[model samples]
Target: MTDTSIEPSADAPAQLSTLDRFLPVWIGAAMLIGIVLGKAIPDLDETLDAIKIDTVSLPIAIGLLAMMYPVLAKVKYTRIGESLDRRSLVMSLVLNWLIGPALMFALAWILLPDLPEYRTGLIIVGLARCIAMVLIWNDLACGSRELAAVLVAINSLFQIVAYSILGYFYLELLPEWLGLDSDGIDVTMWEIAKSVLIFLGIPLLAGFLTRTIGERAKGVEWYEERFLPRIGPVALYGLLFTIVILFALQGEQITEQPWDVARIAVPLLIYFALMWFGSYFAGLKMGFPYERNTSIAFTAAGNNFELAIAVSIGVFGVTSGQALAGVVGPLIEVPVLVALVYVSLWAKRRYYDTDGVRPRS
Candidate 1:
């Protein structure tokens, strides 16, 4: 078995060094193209609309599965047991489930209560952490890939349980606490579980299985070198395509409610800043090195929208305000995360000695 705790060498091409530099531009272009194509091409919209694959939920599931492989392959599974630091793990869990979500709820309440639709949207965005994109960013920031893999796996598992529990408490129980009635609310917990299972669980399982099989057959080095990089872009493309289709379907809503976009962006911006600094500063205080600190920060900062969207649609109905909020998460997340990667790299130079800690050139 490959030791998952071993960090990949900075020189390894297994990670996307070149693309990381220009990721923001690429993501922006992809979003623009998606929007333009979604608006201009009637047939394309109709085609995406016509094709439905609920049983397998292929696009999102496949995209997620594909995205995780590269990250998982770097796990150094052989050393994974040695890398289990309880302090780091507990801190991350408390921050993600407790601190992160609570902060998001408070921010959304303050910033968006006047706009119900956007308030709900902000909630969805706040609840979901970035499972796929953070790993990529962590790699770019020269963070501990092993820790990232473990966190991603753990987060994926917790998201299903925590999403349902926290979502209920926030959307329902908290409303009651605030003296609001949730009498006619039609949200169902089972639906949330189902969506998580289809979108997150299946894809995660597929990625794990694929990695396991690949490692067994080709060895960890071969799987990481030969397979993961080739498939990494596919995951991003898949995610992009799914988002385009989603936005295309809801183009009219976006067109009509221009302010809704701004509303969604606000809490997201706040959440991103909070998580980034919270993790970075916390890690620094905990005496972590730059590499591990960067990983912790980025991992905490990112939101996993695939799972978020899936759960939002499940809990709030496809056209519900919450689902719309989930849709807008990527709009802000992609660009912001890319920018942070650059910021993290810069931080590395200013704080850590450049002798051995420089990001891959």
Candidate 2:
């Protein structure tokens, strides 16, 4: 059996490279730089808008593809079917699909009742569940790589099916059912599905093929250590590039409407806390091992911001408040989830023994 557990270390942050360590800083810098460029260049948005692939800006689409590829490639496709019987997997599905989105819908409506576009954008973020960086967060907390990999693959597959359905439910049907006013998404379910197919399906297939072929030709060690390391940094570069272009497109709106950004953040902050802590303690009560618990918690808490950004831009124009709300997701998520790594560690010590087994109360 593949050893799925990450070896625990004293410094979880030390497990990360400097680039990952200062990710939020880099993203902030990218935003500032993009804003500066937008302010400097009078026709930046027009230039970006000139080219499009299925309603997404060509430049942003390129960046989104770049950002998603390496991360998906890191998933262990071979390990997917290994341990499907575990209760943790079922629990994770419930948290990710049912609870997570419903909570976001409630919070977005409750907190931003006046701002429909931003509200719709946050709902999209909630639906685009974690398939990317939760692996890093899980590993950082010394969680189960085997479970994380399997869970990610399952979530990735589930995304292609559930995202559009959930999008319609929350964005259109739910509001009308409850007598709440909604602008309603202009795009058809097919339009949303097409976006998902392009942005997520393409990268997911590429990543799976890359790993499968690379491992077959070169063996797992070289494929993982050498090739993956070389291409891994490309994900960060792509994310920053996308952010820069996104901010450049909406620099004036973001700068002029700073309070609007702040309002979007409040619901996100509450959502992250509620999901992470709620999942963690729920795992504890269910008597999950520490590693699996950590894995479930992070997986449940994180959002696929890359997919969210892509879909928002695809369905709503790049300049819309919906896209801006999607962009703000990672900006808030990165820092908040990073802090939760320490919180996970602290919970382990507080509730579980050194062997990662919880004590009976």
Candidate 3:
């Protein structure tokens, strides 16, 4: 589903279908629509391409910014210091950056050994950890919004450094070790840094300012109860719009060989499911309660695909396999995470303690 918070939108309808509950149908429809348009309007990318400055597409950049601003606006800054549940934070970091990346490295090599572009694209996706939308998934599962918010705050900054270093290491050096071709896939650390700065850094600052000023002026209650709800759906709607343009640009590439899209999606599906289960069980074994554990699970399982796609397009070309893979990310992620959302809900009731209390180790 869309990555908006579980907080009900100010203007939401009371009833939501299974399709409405998750974003797969909507996101998938967007993908198909983009693809169809791409096929129908073979020159669509060119038309969009005309409205660009330097390498960055103005429309795409704005679309990407719109997707993240709402999520950033809701960061509970006070919790940045107070929400340090040491056990939960450490586990999330390990699963997200360390184990998760290693798992992706293995999967990418095994699954996409030959296709370096697609393989590198998947690895880039792994390097960029979830910041914004996992908050949405975490909230939906009745997890700690504060913990989710704090982790996002931490990861948003961490990604600036970690993504570039890891991107270089995995996308560059890892291939050297495996003896795979490392030719045109040389997207340097700086390239990623630039994209992260524009895509993530701006939103983080804006979100922080929005929260700090809004709370100070309008009062915390109004900011949370009224302002947050109004902007809540922006990220979701932005995501759909970005997808249309992405698939439209990627149309020829996608239509020429549709199976490549499926191939790239394979590792992403495995990563999301495995990481979620791994984090969930790890939390239980470590004795964190259900709410805290779900926060850890979703944070580890979800990805910052907005950053991934932007970096891929900036570093790799818009029509490059890497960018295409980045676009395909949400197509797979929304559904997989939605299923896991249900799975987490089931586990919340059947497997986890409803009271969300566990003894310290």
Candidate 4:
């Protein structure tokens, strides 16, 4: 029988390395390389664009699933119950589900009100919360690893249901409220459900099974120290490849409407900063310890762009403005969050005692 005992903890030093450290630089390079390749080779880009059935690119689907696998496999679903002690979990949940999506909705409307495609793209991005990367940020900020794991696990479970249901309503209702064209709002539950099932559901199941089987077969030490490390970077490698394909496919849009990328970025930038600080201050006001506060801040601020991009392409099209917005999300988020990792650490130092006490004032 398998031990089924592995769960991510804040206590373990983040598994980040030099390559992981420079992830943003590598992602940026991927974008540039994609753009150049798409522009330079017309036949290659056309061939990739044509390699799709049911509007989902085969290459992209493979890359996204591959990228997602390693990340999902590490989730310690077993530890979720114990990690729920902190009231701050409530704060993080509210931020992720209620506040975060609503804020993104308002920002997208306010910033890109007339541009429905772009607005819808941002809306898609807003609804999909971060599940995996927040763990990395949590570790970097010296936040509660246990709580981060719990929140991520909760989100991981919630998203398979919430993403489709919430997406259906938000995309449908919000446009009518704001008086934008309702065409993009016609996404069906089936579409959102299909995207979630393919993009998130498959990997989650695979992750659970892989961990269960591997631990049972090889014991914990070999599974953790050897097996885990080998598969750890698969998702990132897949990300680079997917980015290349996405940008290559949309090279024309990128080159012709260069400002579109910047336009999509505005709401994302505002969203990231606002979520981080808003949650940070809210946690402090509620008297959460620094550890819980940082966890809340990063969890609120980060997004699962992989799911967002996959869903956008599934629901919208690969070359859609929505997909473009989804692509731009991680592009802007990584660097911004990288800088904010420091901000979190500095804030930890400035406002909290070394013992995780919140400063008065």
Provide the TM-score for each candidate, comma-separated. 0.83, 0.84, 0.84, 0.79
Q: For candidate 4, write residues 230-340 as lDDT tens digits.
A: 886776788778778867876667787878888888889999999999988888888787777887799899988767776777667767788788877877886788678
Which pairs of residues collide in candidate 4?
A: 10-145, 67-235
Model 4 ranges with Cα > 4 A deviation: 1-16, 43-46, 49-55, 131-150, 156-172, 175-182, 287-292, 314-316, 352-361
**What RMSD does each model have against the real structure?**
4.5, 3.6, 4.0, 4.7
Query: Over the stretch 44-121, how does candidate 2's per-residue lDDT look in tens digits?
Result: 876876777656567877887887787667767767576355698889999999999999999999999999999989
**Which digits, one per residue and each the tens of the lDDT, describe model 3 over residues 145-210?**
677877776787677667767877787787778787653344555655565677667887898899
Regions of candidate 3 where Cα sits further than 4 Å from its true position: 1-22, 358-361
- Stretches of candidate 2 above 4 Å error? 1-6, 139-142, 314-316, 355-361
lDDT of 3: 0.74
Relative to the true structure, how large is the alpha-carbon lDDT of every model? 0.66, 0.79, 0.74, 0.73
- CA lDDT, candidate 3, residue 313: 74
lDDT of 1: 0.66
- Candidate 1 has a TM-score of 0.83
